[model samples]
Target: MSLGAERRHIRDVTAWQPRVPGVVEVFHAHYTEYAYPMHVHDAWTLLVVDDGAVRYDLDRHEHGTPHGTVTLLPPHVPHNGEPVTEAGFRKRVLYLEPGALDTSLIGAAVDEPDLRDPLLRRRVGQLHTALAHPGDELEAESRLVLVRERLRHHLRPRPVRQPHPDERPLARRLRELLDERTAQGVTLGEAAALVHAHPAHLVRAFSTAFGIAPHQYLMSRRVEHARRLLLAGQPPGEVAALSGFYDQAHLTRHFKRWVGVPPGRYARTSASLT
Candidate 1:
């Protein structure tokens, strides 16, 4: 049986609220003649299309979402979704907390950057099945662990260097420093010193090349590191220390703002799956 199509268009915060705790709210949305304007959320939004095509713009990047494909949005990033066909778009969205991913067996698996893995796809399918049937929390959680493991393994590959002809030597060094010190923390002054440039010049040049301020880019890297640690079952306090946040509360505030959930919840849900 198919979940009935919901045609409402959500354009404001009042139209959205947090779904049930621990459970990923699944919805089959049909945009026959409507679209969702730019908005942001506080949870992981996983969109899996089953029919038609959906065009989404996230952080200035445009994507054409097709059937059998998934799109993941980390919280608070502005995005807009629209149908590419007159037939409109039909898709399932799964809203999950970080804690819903914790499983000792799959702990490492969920830590990967990329979430698109065959195993993860299967697990997402299982989650859809579980949502279709109520009162099967145990089975749902079990499948969640399997999906987490596959995602972790698939994401554990080493970073690949993409060719960049426009990258200057100093800019490249700055990028490297950001990556290396993301978990360790680096101040603007410190980064500027590394490249022998003044802080103001560095800031302007970095922003020109990356389209975001240097400090913002640094914060994003730190958050990315924190996310991996949290997914790997690390405590918020520890992740804060490692990721250069001043304290657990600081990390919590930013993590929630960006990821749409606190570290504790992410850790707990991940742990429950094991």
Candidate 2:
């Protein structure tokens, strides 16, 4: 319901713990004049303002996440949410576990927090509704996957890197470097310096030699490592560190992109299949 320009009589806060394995907390709140003071969370704060409009600030930058925008705040990032209109706003929030998502997805949100995608908004509702039910975990997880995928689409940049057929040698050296230092992220310049090539040239050459960018190949290796860890029953947080991902959320983003699903879900499905 659109709270619109008129203040409604709704003033309530309903919060609970989702019975789902990875979710931390779920909350629904309606406000008219409430302005939250700047705060920080230890988990990824996912919010969907259903009606009217809500505004928030992350790392000193303000954002408006109304009906269509999804508010994504990475862990430890300070933020505040308040109503935008006199009628205030209504919001559904999910405070995900620190290890709930891949650290890279959260990084994407950190770079572009206000995800203004219509499909993502709908998927959020679907995921939330599924989460509201306690026993339909399969459905909830299914919806969560789609929601995350859509969010990732908005958060990640897809640049086409064309390869130079003759530069495979340089690209090969960069690939070796990436394999050697999977945990420590290598910059384009670093890869270039290692092979005595310009950054752009090295990128093209790497793509030519491996059919994927230097970063992509490295990430694929990391994803494979994370997958093994998951299959071994290691948690996402530990898997993230072990797989050379910066964090669980970062691992999630890359894992989903490479493996077609999040690590937790992959592990569960693999276990069931096994």
Candidate 3:
């Protein structure tokens, strides 16, 4: 098929992924001839250009992203985008909710939308890749930290962190509760009540101590539970329901997303390898 025909077979992935807190949407697209209308997003729009280039007008100023460039479009900024090359462009875009980046860090990006740091660019790309797979929660979070640190280093230095009181005990307790109620699932409020803290406070504390959100930690654990059950020869349907997922399809969705393959494929592969 011609490149144009091949492009036709592909569809733009404008998925509203809530994989992480403070993130609203994740977009991945390859376009040969596409243009966006002048619009604004309520969340920060971060773009990672993989191949080719994109031209856009951000806040009334024109900008061009060359191949391998990464750009940050702050929230509420009006912008429109179109391809700058014949091959068009392939990009991963993130729509992050407010508070993902501190107010202080945003100004630098406003003055310079396209960043030149290779490390920052690389981590952004890695973040996207990790988010697409299963069991990559830690990697994704780690990349987020590095990306933030890199941005801070370039824009303005943050005060060095000192030793702080440990909150691991609370984090551990929350994890235990989640494990005990895996199938039934504990609401954040229930977890907070069990821990004798406000739900919002509990979320912040748990994430601070563990480096991953409570919901994410529970999700990873459930996926782990399903893996064990699957390895023991349980069918996907049972694994799904038993592992806190509503049904087989629900389980398959999170399973493949976190584990890199569907449960059946994972089981069959493991059997062959063994």
The CA lDDT of each predicted structure is: 0.59, 0.70, 0.69
- Tens digit per residue, CA lDDT, model 3, 140-247: 777777776776666652332211366667766886787688678988877888898888878887766544566766666677677667766678888898899988
- Candidate 2's displacement at residue 27, Å, is 0.6
Clash pairs of candidate 2? Answer: 101-249, 102-249, 102-250, 102-252, 103-248, 103-249, 103-250, 103-251, 104-249, 104-250
Q: Each candidate: RMSD to true structure?
A: 10.7, 13.7, 12.8
Better of 1 and 3 by TM-score: 3
Candidate 2 structure quality by residue, lDDT tens digits, 147-170: 767766676643323235477567
Over 10-125, each residue of candidate 1 has an lDDT whose tens digit, in order, gives: 21110011123454444454556666545444356666776788886765567776556556655434456777986776676766664554333132222322244555666788
- The residue pairs in collision within model 3 are 134-257, 134-258
Arrange candidates by TM-score, highest first: which order? 3, 2, 1
* Model 1: residues with Cα > 4 Å off, grouped in runs: 1-60, 64-68, 71-167
Question: Which regions of candidate 3 are displaced past 4 Å?
Answer: 1-10, 14-18, 156-274
- Model 2 ranges off by over 4 Å: 1-10, 157-274
Judge candidate 2 at residue 177 and give its lDDT.
89
Give the C-alpha miss distance for residue 74 in model 2, angstroms: 1.0
Candidate 2 has its poorest 10 consecutive residues by lDDT at 156-165
lDDT of 2 at 10: 45
TM-score for each predicted model, relative to the true structure:
0.49, 0.53, 0.53
